[model samples]
Target: MQVASNFKVLFIAGFGPIVREPSESRELYCEVLGIPFKEESGGYLHTEALQGAKTFALWPLSQAAHSCFDSDSWPEDIPVPQAWLEFDGDSVEKATANLESRGYRILVRNKQEPWGQTVTRFLSPEGILVGVTFTPSMRKEK
Candidate 1:
């Protein structure tokens, strides 16, 4: 089925590998590759200031689980995602609603994160965790 024309995806906000090992992953992405990710609580490492088509990150699986299901573990029935992708829309709320109306299963709805982002999350058909987010801190200064 075709999605509605109004539900245009403005751009990809973030994309990266979801890792089980934070220290090793941090060594690769932050130390070795020098991606300049700031260390956050619970092994999550990310940077919103990266210059590219998408902000990159090395997110922990446990963190992903917490964000999607409010638990420390991914549900046994659901496939564990290998990666994640977040989209920035003109209006995150509208985008989320649009996706839901189209029969997408929203795992998290308009959840405000501690780092200051409002996000709605779901799993893609391929099991990648997807987020529709409005993160003011990530906005480039005009």
Candidate 2:
């Protein structure tokens, strides 16, 4: 049975591994796979060339930590996520509420990033860092 909710995911905004080793990740995604990733500050490597996802990147663990907790280290109480996935939705607030009502503990709630994306984050059963987001730039691409 499918339970309906106010939250609606429009598309997958992004997906990538939360890399502990930047060099190894880069070597595999860029060198071995020839992903043509562009390096950014904080050792972030990303590319929009991949067809299935709007963005694909090797997101450094420290960067993910900083994004979620405003610190360079992940909280010890939380399980370290191996990768991250984002779902672009109609309303982040609604999605957040839905998740909370379903008993999911949210990590971050409707936080806007410096790069102009509003997101609510949490961890999935498989340990993937998931984000319900409203990304204006990505929506504009549609």
Candidate 3:
């Protein structure tokens, strides 16, 4: 088989949040963390944080809830992708604890991966899966 020569991750595109409670997610994400994000309930919220990169979008609360839990009624708007955005950090455990201490739900706790990465995951206000990870030094050899 011929090898494909192109290898790049320009966007490395990760899914953004589509919250159940736009206000709360926005408040926690923007107000609490001081991360700049816009609010758009009708269609979805788009952010300017990652320019020239992929953008994040939000959906209405009702629509998102229905989409995830299997509601009979589906929104006319396009469905948000079912994926998680992986954010690499120096301290995954520290970050996970901080979010948990603040009362945010934690879907997964800090767990060590065989590949040498510590990871944690959770649902955003909109029900989208979000994650934080750290590459453990042991995996540096690979």
Candidate 4:
């Protein structure tokens, strides 16, 4: 059997530090560290203002569940993730198709997120939420 080529992960698209206690978590990352975060009432802490090569976010578990499974609760079969990582890919569709062909269960595919990213998401063996994505806004000006 011919093996498929490895998916080309361009770079880190985003990093979400999963939080269970939003209020306390916000106090730390936002108040203590002085990370300018636009707090959401729904518990998603985010900012495009952070100066870095990689974007950072404070993601609530409930929000993650809604994004992945379209529900407020995580499926009992899949382990709850402590954090989420999105990897930039050349073609999210092709990468997603390859994963499916290799028997990986895709939770979401080619979903255009509200922030304008085309993503394919799944759970890693270690239970971390992972995504293969193409986010145009994250691209740097040449």
Clash count for each candidate, listed in order shown:
0, 0, 5, 0
* Candidate 4 structure quality by residue, lDDT tens digits, 1-142: 4546876656556565666666655654564335687767887878887544466578889889999889999899888987777778678988787767756678998899999999888765545687888999988789
Candidate 2 per-residue lDDT, tens place, 11-126, comes to: 77666776666775565446433468888899888878765668767899999999899999999999998888787767899888877776778999999998889999988655
Clashes of 4: 0
lDDT, each prediction: 0.74, 0.79, 0.60, 0.74
Task: Report lDDT (Cα) of residue 127, candidate 3.
Answer: 51
102, model 4: CA deviation in Å?
Answer: 1.0
**Best candidate (score: TM-score):** 2
Regions of model 2 farther than 4 Å from truth? 1-51
Name the weakest run of 10 consecutive residues (lDDT summed) in model 2: 25-34
Output the better candidate (3/4) by lDDT: 4
Write the residue-wise lDDT of candidate 1 on 1-142 in tens digits. 5777878666766667766566655554454334577777886777887655556678999989988888999999887877787766557788777767767678899999998899998765555687878888888899
Q: So what's the TM-score on candidate 2?
A: 0.63
Clashing pairs in 1: none
Tell me each candidate's RMSD, in Å, in order. Answer: 16.8, 16.2, 9.6, 16.7
Runs with alpha carbons beyond 4 Å of true place in candidate 1: 1-54
Error (Å) of candidate 2 at residue 4 is 47
Question: Model 1 compared with the native: what TM-score?
Answer: 0.61
What local lDDT score does residue 116 receive in model 2, on the 0 to 100 scale?
88
